[model samples]
Target: MSYVGRFAPSPSGPLHFGSLVAALGSYFQAKSQHGKWLVRMEDLDPPREMPGASDLILATLEAYHLHWDDEVIYQSQRHHYYQDQIEQWIASKEAYYCQCTRRQIKQSGGFYLGTCRDAALTPEQPCSVRFKVPTAIDHFIDQKHGRIAIPKALADEDFIIKRRDGLYAYNLAVVLDDIEQGVTEVVRGADLIEPTGRQINLYHAMKQPEVSYLHLPLALDEHGNKLSKQNHAPALNNEEPIETLLSAMTFLGFDIDAHITSANLDEIIAWGCQNWSLQQLPNSLASTARF
Candidate 1:
Protein backbone atom coordinates (compact mmCIF):
# COMPACT_ATOMS: atom_id res chain seq x y z
CA MET A 1 0.00 0.00 0.00
CA SER A 2 1.12 3.54 -0.64
CA TYR A 3 2.21 5.54 2.39
CA VAL A 4 -0.67 7.71 3.69
CA GLY A 5 -0.34 9.75 6.86
CA ARG A 6 -2.58 12.43 8.34
CA PHE A 7 -2.71 15.34 10.78
CA ALA A 8 -6.20 15.41 12.29
CA PRO A 9 -6.63 18.39 14.59
CA SER A 10 -9.73 19.16 16.63
CA PRO A 11 -11.10 22.65 16.03
CA SER A 12 -11.18 23.51 19.70
CA GLY A 13 -8.84 26.48 19.25
CA PRO A 14 -6.13 27.93 17.06
CA LEU A 15 -2.88 26.09 16.47
CA HIS A 16 -0.29 26.48 19.22
CA PHE A 17 3.41 25.64 19.25
CA GLY A 18 2.68 22.09 20.39
CA SER A 19 0.17 21.74 17.54
CA LEU A 20 2.82 22.94 15.07
CA VAL A 21 5.31 20.37 16.33
CA ALA A 22 2.93 17.51 15.62
CA ALA A 23 1.92 18.93 12.25
CA LEU A 24 5.52 19.53 11.19
CA GLY A 25 6.62 16.08 12.28
CA SER A 26 3.80 14.43 10.37
CA TYR A 27 4.35 16.56 7.28
CA PHE A 28 8.10 15.92 7.26
CA GLN A 29 7.64 12.20 7.67
CA ALA A 30 5.21 12.01 4.74
CA LYS A 31 7.45 14.15 2.53
CA SER A 32 10.62 12.28 3.51
CA GLN A 33 9.08 9.04 2.29
CA HIS A 34 7.44 10.66 -0.77
CA GLY A 35 4.06 9.73 0.68
CA LYS A 36 0.74 11.57 0.68
CA TRP A 37 -0.11 13.61 3.76
CA LEU A 38 -3.74 14.51 4.39
CA VAL A 39 -5.50 16.72 6.93
CA ARG A 40 -8.80 16.08 8.70
CA MET A 41 -10.93 18.26 10.93
CA GLU A 42 -12.12 16.47 14.07
CA ASP A 43 -15.13 18.68 14.69
CA LEU A 44 -17.51 16.07 16.09
CA ASP A 45 -18.01 17.70 19.45
CA PRO A 46 -19.90 20.89 18.69
CA PRO A 47 -20.17 21.90 22.33
CA ARG A 48 -16.38 22.02 22.60
CA GLU A 49 -15.70 23.62 19.22
CA MET A 50 -15.04 27.33 18.86
CA PRO A 51 -16.61 29.35 16.04
CA GLY A 52 -14.43 29.60 12.91
CA ALA A 53 -11.71 27.35 14.37
CA SER A 54 -11.77 24.97 11.41
CA ASP A 55 -10.97 27.69 8.88
CA LEU A 56 -8.39 29.21 11.23
CA ILE A 57 -6.61 25.86 11.54
CA LEU A 58 -6.41 25.41 7.77
CA ALA A 59 -5.11 28.95 7.41
CA THR A 60 -2.43 28.28 10.00
CA LEU A 61 -1.26 25.20 8.11
CA GLU A 62 -1.07 27.20 4.90
CA ALA A 63 0.86 30.00 6.64
CA TYR A 64 3.39 27.43 7.88
CA HIS A 65 3.60 25.77 4.42
CA LEU A 66 2.28 22.48 5.77
CA HIS A 67 0.23 21.55 2.73
CA TRP A 68 -1.91 18.44 2.63
CA ASP A 69 -2.47 16.36 -0.52
CA ASP A 70 -6.21 15.68 -0.66
CA GLU A 71 -9.38 17.43 0.34
CA VAL A 72 -9.75 17.74 4.11
CA ILE A 73 -12.47 15.62 5.79
CA TYR A 74 -14.75 16.66 8.62
CA GLN A 75 -16.09 14.26 11.26
CA SER A 76 -19.24 16.24 11.94
CA GLN A 77 -20.38 15.57 8.37
CA ARG A 78 -19.93 11.79 8.61
CA HIS A 79 -22.38 10.97 11.37
CA HIS A 80 -24.55 8.66 9.26
CA TYR A 81 -21.60 6.42 8.49
CA TYR A 82 -20.62 6.16 12.16
CA GLN A 83 -24.22 5.49 13.14
CA ASP A 84 -24.54 2.75 10.52
CA GLN A 85 -21.46 1.03 11.89
CA ILE A 86 -22.81 1.30 15.40
CA GLU A 87 -26.02 -0.40 14.29
CA GLN A 88 -24.08 -3.17 12.63
CA TRP A 89 -21.98 -3.78 15.73
CA ILE A 90 -25.08 -3.96 17.88
CA ALA A 91 -26.76 -6.42 15.55
CA SER A 92 -23.66 -8.58 15.21
CA LYS A 93 -23.11 -8.88 18.95
CA GLU A 94 -19.72 -7.20 18.63
CA ALA A 95 -20.94 -4.44 20.95
CA TYR A 96 -23.45 -3.81 23.68
CA TYR A 97 -25.36 -0.90 25.19
CA CYS A 98 -23.70 0.58 28.26
CA GLN A 99 -25.60 2.61 30.85
CA CYS A 100 -22.92 2.79 33.51
CA THR A 101 -22.19 6.32 34.68
CA ARG A 102 -18.73 7.79 35.17
CA ARG A 103 -19.14 7.64 38.92
CA GLN A 104 -20.06 3.97 38.67
CA ILE A 105 -16.94 3.22 36.67
CA LYS A 106 -14.80 5.28 39.04
CA GLN A 107 -16.14 3.23 41.92
CA SER A 108 -14.95 0.14 40.08
CA GLY A 109 -11.30 1.22 40.22
CA GLY A 110 -11.32 3.78 37.41
CA PHE A 111 -11.36 1.23 34.56
CA TYR A 112 -14.69 -0.05 33.33
CA LEU A 113 -15.36 -3.56 34.61
CA GLY A 114 -18.01 -4.71 32.09
CA THR A 115 -20.84 -3.87 34.46
CA CYS A 116 -23.40 -3.63 31.64
CA ARG A 117 -22.14 -6.38 29.34
CA ASP A 118 -25.05 -8.60 30.31
CA ALA A 119 -27.59 -5.85 30.85
CA ALA A 120 -29.14 -6.30 27.37
CA LEU A 121 -30.46 -2.80 27.61
CA THR A 122 -32.45 -1.52 24.64
CA PRO A 123 -31.20 1.45 22.63
CA GLU A 124 -34.49 3.18 23.47
CA GLN A 125 -33.19 3.89 26.93
CA PRO A 126 -30.39 6.40 27.23
CA CYS A 127 -27.18 4.42 26.67
CA SER A 128 -23.78 4.43 25.07
CA VAL A 129 -22.36 1.66 22.86
CA ARG A 130 -19.20 -0.17 23.89
CA PHE A 131 -17.02 -2.58 21.98
CA LYS A 132 -16.87 -5.97 23.67
CA VAL A 133 -13.14 -6.37 24.25
CA PRO A 134 -11.70 -9.81 23.70
CA THR A 135 -9.46 -11.16 26.46
CA ALA A 136 -6.08 -10.80 24.85
CA ILE A 137 -2.99 -8.70 25.39
CA ASP A 138 -2.75 -5.90 22.82
CA HIS A 139 0.71 -4.87 21.72
CA PHE A 140 2.25 -2.73 18.96
CA ILE A 141 5.70 -1.45 18.01
CA ASP A 142 6.07 2.31 18.03
CA GLN A 143 8.51 3.56 15.39
CA LYS A 144 10.20 5.72 18.03
CA HIS A 145 9.35 4.01 21.34
CA GLY A 146 9.94 0.40 20.34
CA ARG A 147 7.62 -2.45 21.38
CA ILE A 148 4.80 -1.52 23.74
CA ALA A 149 2.36 -3.92 25.40
CA ILE A 150 -0.86 -2.62 26.87
CA PRO A 151 -1.57 -4.07 30.31
CA LYS A 152 -3.91 -7.06 30.08
CA ALA A 153 -6.33 -5.31 32.42
CA LEU A 154 -6.68 -2.31 30.14
CA ALA A 155 -6.76 -4.37 26.96
CA ASP A 156 -9.68 -6.41 28.24
CA GLU A 157 -11.87 -3.55 29.36
CA ASP A 158 -14.86 -2.85 27.12
CA PHE A 159 -14.47 0.69 25.80
CA ILE A 160 -17.07 3.15 24.60
CA ILE A 161 -17.57 3.74 20.87
CA LYS A 162 -20.53 6.08 21.18
CA ARG A 163 -21.69 8.32 24.00
CA ARG A 164 -25.13 8.52 25.61
CA ASP A 165 -25.55 12.04 24.33
CA GLY A 166 -25.90 10.71 20.76
CA LEU A 167 -22.31 11.50 19.89
CA TYR A 168 -19.64 9.16 18.56
CA ALA A 169 -16.55 8.54 20.69
CA TYR A 170 -13.06 9.54 19.64
CA ASN A 171 -11.73 5.98 19.43
CA LEU A 172 -14.49 4.91 17.07
CA ALA A 173 -14.40 8.01 14.88
CA VAL A 174 -10.61 8.16 14.58
CA VAL A 175 -10.06 4.49 13.71
CA LEU A 176 -12.89 4.47 11.19
CA ASP A 177 -11.62 7.66 9.60
CA ASP A 178 -8.07 6.35 9.28
CA ILE A 179 -9.28 3.13 7.74
CA GLU A 180 -11.48 5.02 5.28
CA GLN A 181 -8.69 7.42 4.36
CA GLY A 182 -6.23 4.53 3.96
CA VAL A 183 -3.86 6.06 6.45
CA THR A 184 -0.67 3.97 6.43
CA GLU A 185 0.83 5.46 9.57
CA VAL A 186 -0.24 7.74 12.42
CA VAL A 187 2.34 10.38 13.39
CA ARG A 188 1.29 12.53 16.26
CA GLY A 189 2.31 13.56 19.80
CA ALA A 190 3.03 11.09 22.61
CA ASP A 191 0.07 12.44 24.59
CA LEU A 192 -2.15 10.13 22.48
CA ILE A 193 -0.11 6.97 23.13
CA GLU A 194 -2.48 5.75 25.81
CA PRO A 195 -5.29 5.19 23.27
CA THR A 196 -3.20 3.28 20.72
CA GLY A 197 -4.03 -0.10 22.21
CA ARG A 198 -7.75 0.55 22.26
CA GLN A 199 -7.61 1.72 18.65
CA ILE A 200 -5.62 -1.35 17.67
CA ASN A 201 -8.32 -3.49 19.22
CA LEU A 202 -10.89 -1.64 17.14
CA TYR A 203 -9.01 -2.60 14.02
CA HIS A 204 -8.93 -6.18 15.16
CA ALA A 205 -12.67 -6.18 15.80
CA MET A 206 -13.46 -4.65 12.45
CA LYS A 207 -10.89 -6.89 10.72
CA GLN A 208 -9.35 -3.83 9.09
CA PRO A 209 -5.66 -3.39 8.50
CA GLU A 210 -3.94 -1.58 11.34
CA VAL A 211 -1.63 1.32 10.54
CA SER A 212 1.87 1.96 11.90
CA TYR A 213 2.37 4.57 14.61
CA LEU A 214 5.08 7.12 15.39
CA HIS A 215 4.44 9.34 18.40
CA LEU A 216 6.50 12.52 18.65
CA PRO A 217 7.69 14.04 21.91
CA LEU A 218 5.23 16.43 23.56
CA ALA A 219 6.11 20.09 24.10
CA LEU A 220 5.73 21.45 27.60
CA ASP A 221 5.35 24.87 29.16
CA GLU A 222 7.38 26.48 31.92
CA HIS A 223 4.98 24.90 34.43
CA GLY A 224 5.85 21.38 33.21
CA ASN A 225 2.39 20.89 31.74
CA LYS A 226 1.96 19.81 28.12
CA LEU A 227 1.36 22.86 25.95
CA SER A 228 -2.35 22.68 25.02
CA LYS A 229 -5.25 24.89 24.12
CA GLN A 230 -6.93 23.91 27.36
CA ASN A 231 -3.86 25.14 29.19
CA HIS A 232 -4.17 28.49 27.42
CA ALA A 233 -1.06 27.94 25.30
CA PRO A 234 -0.56 30.98 23.05
CA ALA A 235 -1.39 30.66 19.37
CA LEU A 236 1.39 30.51 16.78
CA ASN A 237 2.72 33.87 15.56
CA ASN A 238 1.51 33.96 11.95
CA GLU A 239 3.57 37.12 11.30
CA GLU A 240 6.87 35.35 12.12
CA PRO A 241 6.50 31.92 10.49
CA ILE A 242 10.24 31.37 9.97
CA GLU A 243 11.20 32.01 13.59
CA THR A 244 8.35 29.88 14.89
CA LEU A 245 9.07 27.11 12.39
CA LEU A 246 12.73 27.06 13.34
CA SER A 247 11.84 26.91 17.01
CA ALA A 248 9.47 24.00 16.35
CA MET A 249 12.16 22.20 14.36
CA THR A 250 14.63 22.67 17.21
CA PHE A 251 12.16 21.20 19.68
CA LEU A 252 12.02 18.10 17.47
CA GLY A 253 15.81 17.70 18.03
CA PHE A 254 16.98 19.19 14.74
CA ASP A 255 20.27 21.09 14.67
CA ILE A 256 19.13 24.36 13.09
CA ASP A 257 21.68 26.88 11.85
CA ALA A 258 22.14 29.81 14.22
CA HIS A 259 21.40 32.30 11.40
CA ILE A 260 19.84 31.76 8.00
CA THR A 261 19.95 34.84 5.79
CA SER A 262 16.83 35.26 3.59
CA ALA A 263 15.73 31.67 4.16
CA ASN A 264 12.02 31.39 3.34
CA LEU A 265 9.44 29.05 4.92
CA ASP A 266 9.57 26.55 2.03
CA GLU A 267 13.37 26.33 2.19
CA ILE A 268 13.28 25.81 5.96
CA ILE A 269 10.65 23.10 5.60
CA ALA A 270 12.66 21.43 2.85
CA TRP A 271 15.72 21.50 5.09
CA GLY A 272 13.69 19.85 7.83
CA CYS A 273 12.46 17.09 5.52
CA GLN A 274 15.97 16.39 4.24
CA ASN A 275 17.35 16.17 7.81
CA TRP A 276 14.38 14.45 9.45
CA SER A 277 15.54 11.63 11.72
CA LEU A 278 13.24 9.60 13.96
CA GLN A 279 16.21 8.33 15.95
CA GLN A 280 17.27 11.87 16.86
CA LEU A 281 14.00 12.57 18.71
CA PRO A 282 13.92 12.88 22.51
CA ASN A 283 12.59 9.71 24.17
CA SER A 284 11.30 11.72 27.11
CA LEU A 285 7.60 12.63 27.30
CA ALA A 286 7.99 16.33 28.09
CA SER A 287 10.29 19.22 27.06
CA THR A 288 10.12 22.46 29.04
CA ALA A 289 10.37 25.59 26.93
CA ARG A 290 9.59 29.31 27.13
CA PHE A 291 8.72 29.45 23.43
Candidate 2:
Protein backbone atom coordinates (compact mmCIF):
# COMPACT_ATOMS: atom_id res chain seq x y z
CA MET A 1 0.00 0.00 0.00
CA SER A 2 1.17 3.52 -0.75
CA TYR A 3 1.78 5.24 2.59
CA VAL A 4 -0.83 7.70 3.94
CA GLY A 5 -0.29 9.43 7.29
CA ARG A 6 -1.95 12.27 9.23
CA PHE A 7 -1.36 15.00 11.80
CA ALA A 8 -4.53 15.30 13.83
CA PRO A 9 -4.65 18.04 16.46
CA SER A 10 -7.38 19.24 18.77
CA PRO A 11 -8.29 22.92 18.44
CA SER A 12 -8.31 23.66 22.12
CA GLY A 13 -5.52 26.22 21.81
CA PRO A 14 -3.09 27.82 19.34
CA LEU A 15 -0.27 25.73 17.87
CA HIS A 16 2.46 25.43 20.46
CA PHE A 17 6.06 24.18 20.17
CA GLY A 18 5.05 20.58 20.96
CA SER A 19 2.40 20.82 18.24
CA LEU A 20 4.97 21.96 15.69
CA VAL A 21 7.27 19.05 16.46
CA ALA A 22 4.54 16.44 15.96
CA ALA A 23 3.29 18.09 12.76
CA LEU A 24 6.73 18.52 11.25
CA GLY A 25 7.75 15.03 12.25
CA SER A 26 4.67 13.50 10.62
CA TYR A 27 5.06 15.79 7.59
CA PHE A 28 8.67 14.83 6.99
CA GLN A 29 7.93 11.15 7.45
CA ALA A 30 5.10 11.15 4.93
CA LYS A 31 6.89 13.39 2.44
CA SER A 32 9.99 11.21 2.63
CA GLN A 33 7.95 8.23 1.50
CA HIS A 34 6.19 10.34 -1.16
CA GLY A 35 2.91 9.70 0.66
CA LYS A 36 -0.24 11.75 1.10
CA TRP A 37 -0.48 13.60 4.41
CA LEU A 38 -3.80 14.81 5.80
CA VAL A 39 -4.74 17.11 8.68
CA ARG A 40 -7.78 16.69 10.94
CA MET A 41 -9.09 19.08 13.54
CA GLU A 42 -10.35 17.27 16.63
CA ASP A 43 -13.01 19.79 17.66
CA LEU A 44 -15.48 17.41 19.23
CA ASP A 45 -15.47 18.98 22.68
CA PRO A 46 -17.09 22.39 22.20
CA PRO A 47 -16.76 23.21 25.85
CA ARG A 48 -12.97 22.92 25.64
CA GLU A 49 -12.45 24.30 22.13
CA MET A 50 -11.38 27.88 21.48
CA PRO A 51 -13.33 29.81 18.83
CA GLY A 52 -10.34 30.61 16.59
CA ALA A 53 -7.97 27.80 17.47
CA SER A 54 -8.62 25.65 14.39
CA ASP A 55 -8.04 28.52 11.91
CA LEU A 56 -4.95 29.59 13.82
CA ILE A 57 -3.58 26.03 13.68
CA LEU A 58 -3.96 25.98 9.89
CA ALA A 59 -2.29 29.37 9.54
CA THR A 60 0.55 28.21 11.74
CA LEU A 61 1.03 25.08 9.62
CA GLU A 62 1.13 27.21 6.45
CA ALA A 63 3.65 29.53 8.09
CA TYR A 64 5.93 26.56 8.75
CA HIS A 65 5.39 25.17 5.18
CA LEU A 66 3.90 22.06 6.74
CA HIS A 67 1.19 21.85 4.11
CA TRP A 68 -1.50 19.17 4.29
CA ASP A 69 -2.40 17.32 1.10
CA ASP A 70 -6.20 17.44 1.41
CA GLU A 71 -8.90 19.67 2.88
CA VAL A 72 -8.85 19.39 6.66
CA ILE A 73 -11.65 17.34 8.27
CA TYR A 74 -13.30 18.58 11.46
CA GLN A 75 -14.72 16.14 14.01
CA SER A 76 -17.72 18.21 15.09
CA GLN A 77 -19.37 17.93 11.66
CA ARG A 78 -19.19 14.11 11.60
CA HIS A 79 -21.51 13.46 14.49
CA HIS A 80 -23.92 11.32 12.49
CA TYR A 81 -21.17 8.92 11.41
CA TYR A 82 -20.08 8.44 15.01
CA GLN A 83 -23.66 8.05 16.13
CA ASP A 84 -24.29 5.35 13.53
CA GLN A 85 -21.32 3.31 14.72
CA ILE A 86 -22.24 3.77 18.37
CA GLU A 87 -25.72 2.47 17.61
CA GLN A 88 -24.26 -0.58 15.87
CA TRP A 89 -22.05 -1.40 18.85
CA ILE A 90 -24.93 -1.04 21.29
CA ALA A 91 -27.42 -3.03 19.23
CA SER A 92 -24.93 -5.85 18.73
CA LYS A 93 -24.03 -5.98 22.43
CA GLU A 94 -20.40 -5.22 21.54
CA ALA A 95 -20.90 -2.20 23.79
CA TYR A 96 -23.16 -1.33 26.72
CA TYR A 97 -24.44 1.71 28.57
CA CYS A 98 -22.93 2.79 31.90
CA GLN A 99 -24.28 5.14 34.56
CA CYS A 100 -21.19 4.86 36.74
CA THR A 101 -19.59 8.12 37.81
CA ARG A 102 -15.86 8.92 37.79
CA ARG A 103 -15.84 8.46 41.53
CA GLN A 104 -17.36 5.02 41.11
CA ILE A 105 -14.68 3.95 38.64
CA LYS A 106 -11.93 5.38 40.90
CA GLN A 107 -13.28 3.39 43.78
CA SER A 108 -12.76 0.23 41.71
CA GLY A 109 -8.99 0.85 41.85
CA GLY A 110 -8.53 3.40 39.05
CA PHE A 111 -9.25 1.00 36.16
CA TYR A 112 -12.89 0.24 35.54
CA LEU A 113 -13.88 -3.27 36.64
CA GLY A 114 -16.81 -3.84 34.28
CA THR A 115 -19.29 -2.80 36.96
CA CYS A 116 -22.01 -2.07 34.42
CA ARG A 117 -21.24 -4.60 31.71
CA ASP A 118 -24.13 -6.76 32.90
CA ALA A 119 -26.16 -4.17 34.79
CA ALA A 120 -28.86 -3.98 32.06
CA LEU A 121 -27.94 -0.34 31.62
CA THR A 122 -29.69 1.90 29.10
CA PRO A 123 -28.50 4.99 27.21
CA GLU A 124 -30.92 7.25 28.97
CA GLN A 125 -29.77 10.78 29.76
CA PRO A 126 -26.57 10.96 31.81
CA CYS A 127 -25.27 7.56 30.66
CA SER A 128 -22.02 6.72 28.91
CA VAL A 129 -21.43 3.93 26.34
CA ARG A 130 -18.49 1.58 26.81
CA PHE A 131 -17.14 -1.08 24.48
CA LYS A 132 -17.13 -4.57 26.00
CA VAL A 133 -13.48 -5.31 25.26
CA PRO A 134 -12.80 -9.01 24.82
CA THR A 135 -10.37 -11.18 26.72
CA ALA A 136 -8.32 -11.97 23.61
CA ILE A 137 -4.96 -10.18 23.92
CA ASP A 138 -2.79 -8.92 21.09
CA HIS A 139 0.26 -6.77 20.30
CA PHE A 140 1.44 -4.43 17.57
CA ILE A 141 4.77 -3.40 16.12
CA ASP A 142 5.21 0.35 16.12
CA GLN A 143 7.28 1.53 13.16
CA LYS A 144 9.65 3.29 15.54
CA HIS A 145 9.22 1.58 18.90
CA GLY A 146 9.45 -2.02 17.68
CA ARG A 147 7.23 -4.67 19.33
CA ILE A 148 4.73 -3.78 22.06
CA ALA A 149 2.48 -6.09 24.03
CA ILE A 150 -0.92 -4.94 25.21
CA PRO A 151 -1.54 -5.82 28.82
CA LYS A 152 -4.30 -8.46 29.11
CA ALA A 153 -5.87 -6.85 32.19
CA LEU A 154 -6.21 -3.45 30.54
CA ALA A 155 -7.41 -5.03 27.30
CA ASP A 156 -10.29 -6.72 29.08
CA GLU A 157 -11.47 -3.56 30.81
CA ASP A 158 -14.58 -1.94 29.30
CA PHE A 159 -13.64 1.42 27.82
CA ILE A 160 -15.92 4.32 26.92
CA ILE A 161 -16.89 5.11 23.34
CA LYS A 162 -19.31 7.95 24.04
CA ARG A 163 -19.43 10.36 26.96
CA ARG A 164 -22.48 10.87 29.17
CA ASP A 165 -22.73 14.43 27.79
CA GLY A 166 -24.34 13.13 24.58
CA LEU A 167 -21.09 13.86 22.76
CA TYR A 168 -18.75 11.54 20.85
CA ALA A 169 -15.60 10.46 22.64
CA TYR A 170 -12.05 10.67 21.24
CA ASN A 171 -11.47 6.94 20.64
CA LEU A 172 -14.65 6.43 18.62
CA ALA A 173 -14.31 9.56 16.51
CA VAL A 174 -10.65 8.93 15.74
CA VAL A 175 -11.16 5.31 14.69
CA LEU A 176 -14.17 6.18 12.52
CA ASP A 177 -12.35 9.05 10.81
CA ASP A 178 -9.22 7.02 10.18
CA ILE A 179 -11.32 4.27 8.60
CA GLU A 180 -13.16 6.83 6.48
CA GLN A 181 -9.97 8.57 5.34
CA GLY A 182 -7.98 5.32 4.83
CA VAL A 183 -5.16 6.56 7.05
CA THR A 184 -2.29 4.08 6.55
CA GLU A 185 -0.21 5.25 9.45
CA VAL A 186 -0.51 7.30 12.65
CA VAL A 187 2.36 9.54 13.78
CA ARG A 188 2.01 11.40 17.01
CA GLY A 189 3.48 11.75 20.56
CA ALA A 190 4.49 9.30 23.28
CA ASP A 191 1.71 10.51 25.56
CA LEU A 192 -0.76 8.55 23.43
CA ILE A 193 1.05 5.22 23.77
CA GLU A 194 -1.51 3.68 26.10
CA PRO A 195 -4.45 4.82 23.99
CA THR A 196 -3.06 2.94 21.00
CA GLY A 197 -4.14 -0.39 22.50
CA ARG A 198 -7.74 0.75 22.90
CA GLN A 199 -7.68 2.11 19.35
CA ILE A 200 -6.39 -1.19 18.01
CA ASN A 201 -9.15 -2.99 19.88
CA LEU A 202 -11.69 -0.68 18.26
CA TYR A 203 -10.24 -1.49 14.86
CA HIS A 204 -10.75 -5.19 15.56
CA ALA A 205 -14.28 -4.54 16.82
CA MET A 206 -15.04 -2.50 13.71
CA LYS A 207 -13.31 -5.16 11.57
CA GLN A 208 -11.01 -2.62 9.94
CA PRO A 209 -7.34 -3.38 9.38
CA GLU A 210 -5.12 -1.61 11.90
CA VAL A 211 -2.88 1.21 10.71
CA SER A 212 0.82 1.45 11.48
CA TYR A 213 2.01 3.78 14.28
CA LEU A 214 5.13 5.87 14.90
CA HIS A 215 4.99 7.76 18.17
CA LEU A 216 7.51 10.60 18.23
CA PRO A 217 9.45 11.24 21.43
CA LEU A 218 7.63 13.62 23.75
CA ALA A 219 9.19 17.02 24.43
CA LEU A 220 9.52 17.85 28.11
CA ASP A 221 10.44 21.11 29.82
CA GLU A 222 13.40 21.84 32.09
CA HIS A 223 11.26 20.66 34.98
CA GLY A 224 10.61 17.31 33.23
CA ASN A 225 7.03 18.23 32.36
CA LYS A 226 5.71 17.64 28.84
CA LEU A 227 4.95 20.82 26.91
CA SER A 228 1.20 20.92 26.38
CA LYS A 229 -1.59 23.45 25.85
CA GLN A 230 -2.97 22.45 29.25
CA ASN A 231 0.31 23.57 30.82
CA HIS A 232 -0.10 26.95 29.07
CA ALA A 233 2.79 26.17 26.74
CA PRO A 234 3.67 29.20 24.62
CA ALA A 235 2.45 29.19 21.03
CA LEU A 236 4.96 29.06 18.21
CA ASN A 237 6.28 32.27 16.66
CA ASN A 238 5.22 32.19 13.02
CA GLU A 239 7.52 35.17 12.51
CA GLU A 240 10.53 32.82 12.57
CA PRO A 241 9.40 29.73 10.70
CA ILE A 242 12.77 28.22 9.86
CA GLU A 243 14.07 28.70 13.39
CA THR A 244 11.03 26.97 14.82
CA LEU A 245 11.26 24.13 12.32
CA LEU A 246 14.90 23.69 13.21
CA SER A 247 14.02 23.51 16.86
CA ALA A 248 11.52 20.74 16.06
CA MET A 249 14.09 18.92 13.95
CA THR A 250 16.49 19.02 16.87
CA PHE A 251 13.81 17.66 19.18
CA LEU A 252 13.34 14.69 16.84
CA GLY A 253 17.12 14.12 17.06
CA PHE A 254 17.69 15.06 13.43
CA ASP A 255 20.96 16.65 12.35
CA ILE A 256 20.17 19.99 10.64
CA ASP A 257 23.77 21.22 10.20
CA ALA A 258 23.64 20.83 6.40
CA HIS A 259 20.65 23.15 5.78
CA ILE A 260 20.25 25.18 8.96
CA THR A 261 21.90 28.14 7.24
CA SER A 262 22.02 27.13 3.56
CA ALA A 263 18.32 26.59 2.83
CA ASN A 264 15.08 28.50 2.50
CA LEU A 265 11.72 27.15 3.61
CA ASP A 266 11.22 24.67 0.79
CA GLU A 267 14.86 23.58 0.79
CA ILE A 268 14.80 23.03 4.52
CA ILE A 269 11.66 20.91 4.28
CA ALA A 270 13.09 19.06 1.29
CA TRP A 271 16.21 18.29 3.26
CA GLY A 272 14.10 17.13 6.20
CA CYS A 273 12.09 14.67 4.09
CA GLN A 274 15.19 13.29 2.44
CA ASN A 275 17.12 12.76 5.68
CA TRP A 276 14.47 11.96 8.27
CA SER A 277 15.39 8.91 10.38
CA LEU A 278 13.58 7.34 13.30
CA GLN A 279 16.74 5.59 14.45
CA GLN A 280 18.15 8.82 15.88
CA LEU A 281 15.14 9.33 18.15
CA PRO A 282 15.35 8.69 21.89
CA ASN A 283 12.84 6.08 23.04
CA SER A 284 12.97 7.16 26.67
CA LEU A 285 9.57 8.04 28.13
CA ALA A 286 10.42 11.69 27.40
CA SER A 287 13.14 13.93 25.99
CA THR A 288 14.22 17.24 27.57
CA ALA A 289 13.74 20.44 25.56
CA ARG A 290 14.21 24.20 25.83
CA PHE A 291 12.71 25.29 22.52
Best by TM-score: 1
In candidate 1, the residue pairs with backbone N, CA or C atoms under 3 Å apart (3 or more residues apart, or in different chains) clash, namely: none
Q: What global local distance difference test value does model 2 have? A: 0.87
TM-score against truth, every candidate = 0.97, 0.96
lDDT of 2 by residue, 198-236 (tens): 898899898889998998888888888899999888899
In candidate 2, what residue range of length 10 has the lowest lDDT sum? 254-263
How many Å off is the CA of 27 in candidate 2?
0.8
**lDDT for position 161 in model 2:** 92
Q: On a 0 to 1 TM-score scale, where does candidate 2 land against the true structure? A: 0.96
